[model samples]
Target: MTLLFAYTSLYGQTLNYDVIRNDKSMGQTVVKRILKGDELTYHLNTKTELRVIFLFDIEYDLKETFKNGKLISGTGFNTLNGSVQKETQMALKEKFYELVIDGIRTEINETNITESVSEIYFEEPHHSKRVFSAYFGRYLNFEKVGERQYSLTSPDGTNVYTYENGICTKVKVTRDFATFEFILKPESLLAVRNKQITGKTND
Candidate 1:
């Protein structure tokens, strides 16, 4: 019997569930944990729309399973893949293993152009947390854009680090179309990461 957790949709009008499959007890989905089966299944319901059975995951890696589906494509964790390293694991226990970074800023050659800068903060991994940050750019000079601006490159130019318990796991960047995969150890996010959106700078 697979373990299951049921959640209401954001609107509260629909229901969602995670389930495990077994041929012996088919069609009677048990709301339990770790169903003794080869695959994991998810179901979602929406108002005024047919309930959808999202893609099934034969393997729990599930990176491809969720990204390939039409209904749940952009829903979650599409651009991160990799495991945390020993260094990161050790760093997590430290009282202050924090990094504050800046994202890419650009300056156009035209007479009137806007240069933008964004700030980012990362903490040593806590128990059961994953943090993912991706940077994209127009050229290799993401680092040279401006003050307080870090380079934003695709996975090829992007580097990922997971720091926990004083150990750091580095994930090399690689592109998968509009997204990349940088799997983080869940225990590494001591605090929530600020997204890369920019705002007006102090004069």
Candidate 2:
């Protein structure tokens, strides 16, 4: 029966997810959909069109709305090259961030995802979002074991490991009976060479 106000993040990359009551009198908390674009799309707000251009696909004409601890909206078209992938509705809320995925609808509280991450700031060595790096607050670090694998620790001292390319593939957050999780895809680092080499083209 704890009532909480609203929460905001500093940057944007950090995702914020929370739990909320349905009727406020039902005495039952429900998982709500907040922001679909976490720290990756924090720059987007009302009256703004955020464009996410990926190597494989491009997302244009995107819209977002924030209210009542919930985020509801949809994109115009999701195209890989020139075709469309139908229209999909993307909705999430802050309250839902606190509850475990399955824990929300059922009594089971378990899911493999990170929930409610916000107020993130990038330090030195990272300029123009080209490279992503964080302090991890002295609590999170890289642990070496085999060849390409790592273990990431959360703020509450929870450890989640990955064993594919030594990168964080997923993040999970849970409190009381709620858990939220998210999978992260690696960013593209292919530089575009726009230099023209010429040795004096004679007549």
Cα lDDT listed for each candidate: 0.21, 0.25
Tens digit of lDDT per residue, candidate 1, span 27-81? 1111111111332222211111111254221111111111121111101111112
How high is each candidate's TM-score? Answer: 0.16, 0.21
Candidate with the greatest lDDT versus the true structure: 2
Query: Model 2 segments beyond 4 Å from truth?
Result: 1-9, 14-64, 89-203
Q: TM-score: which candidate is best?
A: 2
Expressed as tens digits, the lDDT of each residue in 1-203 for candidate 2 is 11221222222122111212221211111111234444233221111111235323223223333343233222223344445543333334433212122122211121212211110111111111121111121113334333323333445453332222212233333434333333332221010011111111101
Superposed by TM-score, candidate 2 places the C-alpha of residue 191 at a distance from the truth, in angstroms, of 22
How many collisions per candidate?
36, 31
lDDT score for residue 124 of model 1: 25
Global lDDT of model 2: 0.25
CA RMSD per model (angstroms): 20.5, 20.6
